[model samples]
Target chain A: MPKSEFSRRKFLGFAGTASGLVVIAGCNKDEVVSPGTLDGVDLGSGDIGILNYAYALEQLEAAFYTQVIMTQFSGISSPEATLLTDIRDHEVAHREFFKTALGDKAIQDLEVDFSSIDFSSRDSVLATAKAFEDLGVSAYNGAGRLIETADYLVLAGKIVSVEARHAALIRDLISPGSFADDTVINSDGLDGSRKPSEVLMIAQPYIKTVINGANLPTY
Target chain B: MNLSNIIDEIEKADGEAFDRVNSRRSVLRNFAGVTGKAALAALPVAFGSLFKKAYAGTRGVQDVFDVLNYALTLEYLEAEFYVQSLLAPGLLSGQLAMSIQTISKHETAHVNFLKAAITAAGGTPVDKPGFDFSGGKGSGDGPFKNAFSDLGLFLAVAQAFEDTGVRAYKGRAAELLGGEAVTTAALQIHSVEARHAAHIRYMRQQLGSGVGNLQPWITGNMSGIDSELVQPSYNGEENTMQASVEITGINGFEISAESASEAFDEPLTPEQVLAIVDGFIV
Candidate 1:
């Protein structure tokens, strides 16, 4: 079967057995069930849930960039290669930072399905990068209100700006002066924001792991 | 001032002050006895009213009004710089002109939005201060005298302003935390400023004339521009410690200091931001 179809089947299987796995885990009080043992990973609740949500997205971005550098799009210029490599390193650092911060609460490594992306083609690679960076910015923006801890909010603030920076550069790479174009930035000059549920739905196709964001705080 | 006298002063400034204060106090009183999801649900309303009280000139409180006014001042500086740059003859052509025009519109939009928000919150918007883009402090001839005439110098100054704007907003985000609507709006605008900063950095990279090896993201507190005038904007940006965790070489990822710093943008205190911006403000 094709990779996309296979991932879809896997996701459906996880969804079907999600409830059963939760009940099983509940009965085993002393057993420390690993994240991998569950059919779907629950992002936990409150701040941990939000951090895991961020970690999951970072994992997808880091994985994508690693692949981009390894394959290298056809006819990539030296300048482009250098910048893309920098972006990959930044994403890797971000992913690791969240993982380390979350410690035991961090979700297992998410399996990404990038079958839809043509990594060898510049257009395909850049457009996907743009989407991920934009989505990342919006996710942080929306999640900021949900963060109760001031330090966590500030941390989210620190990272969201970098994601915005990445989004702008990727947009410019596609079109010279379209960095803050109207599509992402509204007429009021505000960048877009997306709730976790909305963002997760959009990101579902790219991620093979079934992410349960039901416990995330929403306002 | 005494308590009653202060209350009278606030009432004179805002007629609805007492009503808002009472309602907010009642909410808090009710919330005090309650717990769980219900209290959480009413947080935004309580926070909103609390912010409104702060706007009514509540002493000793750094309210949302102060933050918005601070932002408005910065927006005015940016909006006017772009407006004047576009009007300058023999400067800004082709893609560079287009990018500046796009950024200019956003700055203007931000100015308008902030003014409206302040007004809606029962606070008078601060007047737009006169800006001498040449960094003259009203002298009309400072380090960036050719800011409008020379494209390179213009971009360097623009990059400084955009980077400062991003840092300034990031610094104040925590102040608006409980007020969800304002917090979300500020975050939205904060990201837009970052986008503008990145685009300006990209332009500098493309120019590559007097500008140093500039990347879209800041690297190691190094002001991509060689001049010391713009160095303040990049100060403290070299920080690799986040939430008390030293990011460099953490988790054995071989993450370089530059990459670690680049992954997270540092916040500049309001005083720090004002000091940098005061140079251009007449």
Candidate 2:
């Protein structure tokens, strides 16, 4: 209880180390290491990491929506046409939003090869759309904890909610009654979450930039 | 008992080791709350200012976890709704079952993804709890009938929930700012959610749920039949409904002022989201 002891502990607190009573833990570095190359994406350190991450997803969404609008599947009902066009516009806006937000920090426009997607057929288009949407939702959930500034976090949150909506819509389109079913929602009733490294790995094949995420920090 | 003499003695013995030991000891005392306030009071204005700054009081990572938990909660709600509706009697046709299954898998992935994230973040993944689609228990045909029967109501409610979710995620974006990987995944999910909202609106229109069920993003403010329900001359000669829906009959779509604008989602501070969330948590 001496003043010297009290001051010593306080000084240590100033150094930012955890309290002796505190438990310090981190993800098993080996467990979550991503397998694929980052493609060409460069998520700069700090906030830039987040911006690049968003940019990647926007690239995927823009491509998918563009295909939907361009092909205009045969037998597409009136509602289908209207909604798909609207989605196309939204994706365009999202792609541009990240571009503008990242400004000079933004990476080059991503190259997405959707030759893998069979746009001529509704089944093919919707299925791809569903995968992209679901991936988007899971990506955001996983990345939520990695943000630093509250303001950017808020921005990301707004953007991700929109993505979740996309996932729901795509689900319904593929199947009317499947908007928030077990396939998307887990037993915990929470959406999916993935770390950035994991997300980038999944996105690598679709993107061509060869992302170098080494500079990005993990929680 | 002279403080200066004791300090000199410690310094002469091994300044660096002494300093390190002293620093470690200080951290422990603060851990016990003996030095917290005084040390805080000694901080410079800028550092002190942080104390006054709004916290949204989310328990730092704990609250961030809460926000994630809430997100998971909503995700599950939507996932379950879809899963049940797909199989609900008289809801979806057997022909649509295959598509529903694919969507089902996606939702499943979503749930698992969040579970992993929460686990990664050192928090317990919330187990799925039984959700009440219907407002109450014991209502004869019960919840499914209520949620599934009226396609219009179903679509409308879904729209509202999705919109709210989009806003909610945005509201909590800041809390996740500390971590990069998590933030990136969140933004990806946010974009998907928006698309879902637009797609659902399309389905509502296809099924003739309601006239106003046009895509909100596409709709600025134009008049169609639904606009007639409102007072005539809602927006000068150019109907708001016209801006709202893109149709051949509407003379190609005229971009509304709202459509041309840079629309950012309104942020709900962490404190705000938590306050509301607490009401529902238990």
Candidate 3:
């Protein structure tokens, strides 16, 4: 059996014996909480947890782009507008893909906190888009090693490259010829990667939901 | 011939051959006890199970080393392409030249990093292969012979190489999964290649010679170049089914097939990539 399936069964076994709440001990003595509690949503465990993590990010990206298009930042050019629209559609597609793939295991729709983002200004919107795209790419890159299923790893690979492509375009729009600049691509010619804990902490301000990623695998 | 005799002959040709073999002994350790033809006959199944076990947890050290070497070869090609392009007088200038220069630097870095990684892993880095860049198989008279002289052709070929690099790295990702540090490094490189691909595509879109209307991402399986020589790089990219999920109209949304295909980049097998790359290799 795949490691993910085996771990899911083990997690369910714990859930089965517990009362209303199940607080299992994590690898590093952290408390691994269950989902749908007052503490907020737990991303579950194993492959499902990773999928939900991706889903949550995609939700934020999709919502941000949807609002961007609805407001249509002032002075947006036709090409820029068209590109953002395409990105919005792609984000929505990615969001739906994870939801469908996860099925009953999928997490609930995430509430976004976009108050700090001024969608009216082109600079704000593009900069935020650039941050999200780079974060998404790094998140997937770091998470690849944690995935046990070959198919899921391949699927993530498929999506991450698209996210990278979106990142480059957004960066270019901000500063021409800055697509693969030193800020993201390192001295070794490799892009940066962020652990789930690091990624979620950075993403917490933009997200309203408290995500318990304690059960997610770590490298 | 006796094994000892063969080893002696190899050592004569290459002084570091034993060290190279010893570095990968972990992968060959199991073969030490099996010598008979019967044991050899059963070796295939044993090797399969061995690899399967390795895939389940940590991959073999040699596997990671080999993948790095493969990546190093491609980086050599890309680094040389950009290096030669920048050397060509009046080939590129302004923003285009700057962008190409940035990409060139990254490729050179990739080559150096991969070489260091292979050396660290006790494997000799593969020598940089000679390239034609014209798809002429070293005859220097291929269809893209004027790639350096003409800006339009340079961008087109650049697009092809970057896109191919993205797909090629992705295809080999599964092998590096269990090796955490290497997996992360390869993925980091993979996405950077995607960024390069997208930027090159944008450059091509702006040029509008034959690649006008080209999205930064691949639309379908279209190479966007109309050249059969580079078509293999884009073949199978139109795939919309990922992990058996049909991306088009999933979740009851009216998503077009083109958009669905565009949202995900497909991988090209090593053989497929090599076939496309061989045209430019001598």
Candidate 4:
């Protein structure tokens, strides 16, 4: 259950008012921050902030899978279809969990633009899915420390591994055994995690609302 | 801020910390002064059925160095497993072989990363342990006579390693809070292992050996998995509740209790994981 009254607009307004906490950048258009109100979605500081950040990604994933299922990839194989559908359900469940957990403090439903994706083509669809899933995993890993609550961190761990599973499945479908390729994973066997700011930069094109994670804890 | 272990213990008990501070928190207080940051970084998840069961009484790593080394040892085991599999003359070919090759790289990368990190942090990296995949020690052949001869056994072993790895990292993930970067990096590695596990399951399903409908997770049926060397990896994976909340039948959507448990993977303590890993090591 949500702990407090944390409306999206209210949090954004509060972020602007709360000591210039968030630096909102990377919008589709060159929008300037208003005198007191934030121009885009401002993830609040601390645990709530991290939860909102994750919610945004889950929403994007759920939304993408919804479309993928709506128009199954042209001649999609049975196994692929089944796995994709399973992933969709998982994403929906993850999205709902964050929404309920954050309650009023949760951010508004993020507007996503999948216009660039060629849903009809399996290659196009799986590639974008790969990108989204990979981004989601790294974002969770990157943002783990910003979380103040241990339970929340565990919840994050729970969701992220699934995303990784999704990523690996998508990658294999595209190219068998390419799940943990050299691109995302570095040479050190250590998975490279980006900071929230770095991840949002890559995720911004698909997301309508800009996210301000400048105030998030980075220990 | 890298607070010492003493401060972490003292600070976790809030009131006691205050009392100690009033008394002689000077040593810890001075240590804090030296570090200039909070004694702890990412706090460990303290709730969940498994947390209450698996995490509460178990021992945590002494410091980030020990954490890195523990991880390093596992990576070594995994990396060597893949390397040996690839080296076998008649085990795999084509796509299956290609996949093994790619995974081998990732595991090797992890081993290299942890080794370098431990060395960079002024701690000695744990040396790679010699492995006997056949569950036999010093005999050059183990229980898995077909480790290189049979693909099914190979995948089973891979599943064991990857699944154990996923839970193992999760068990210690939060405890490595002293070094957030390492914990985060470990989390990243953890998911990749999950992906490998899923892929292996997928491969098994494709082979049509009665596990055709296998999902990416453990569904509580341990029928085909008879290897004792890998059985303990499934320890506590049957948990149905998360953070004390039942995962099934929420919001009128009837999700299977099995799927609910599968949705979120549980963690295995280092001791539990090592018990399984040690069986394969000479």
lDDT of every predicted structure (CA atoms): 0.78, 0.51, 0.76, 0.66
User: After superposition, which runs of candidate 4 have C-alpha atoms over 4 Å from their true positions?
Assistant: A1-37, B1-62, B137-142, B220-229
Rank ordering of all candidates by DockQ, starting from the highest: 1, 3, 4, 2
What's the TM for model 3? 0.83
- Candidate 3, clashing residue pairs? none
Candidate 4 C-alpha error for residue A162, in Å: 1.6
- Give the TM-score of chain A, superposed on the true chain A, for all candidates in the order listed: 0.83, 0.80, 0.84, 0.82
Question: All candidates' TM-scores?
Answer: 0.83, 0.54, 0.83, 0.77
Tens digits of per-residue lDDT for model 3 on A155-189?
88999999999999999999999998987886668
> Across residues A1-219, which tens digit of lDDT does each residue of candidate 4 receive?
121122222222332233233354332245554354455687777788878888888888889998998999789988788788778767776777777777899989888867667788777787778778877877887777566566777678777787787777788788877777777665445454656765665666666666666555554
Ranking of all candidate structures by their lDDT, best first: 1, 3, 4, 2
- lDDT digits (tens) for residues B86-202 of candidate 1: 999989888888899999999998898776665555555667767777787788988999999988888888999999999999888777766555677788889999999999999
Please give, as one word, the docking class of candidate 1.
acceptable
DockQ of each: 0.43, 0.17, 0.36, 0.28
Candidate 1 residues lying further than 4 Å off, grouped into runs, are A1-39, B1-62
Q: Where in model 3 is the C-alpha error above 4 Å?
A: A1-38, B1-58
Best lDDT among the predictions, by candidate number = 1
Task: Residues A96-156, candidate 2: write the lDDT tens digits.
Answer: 6667667788878767756455566777677767767666666656655565666566655
Location of the lowest summed lDDT over 10 successive residues in candidate 1 chain B = B28-37
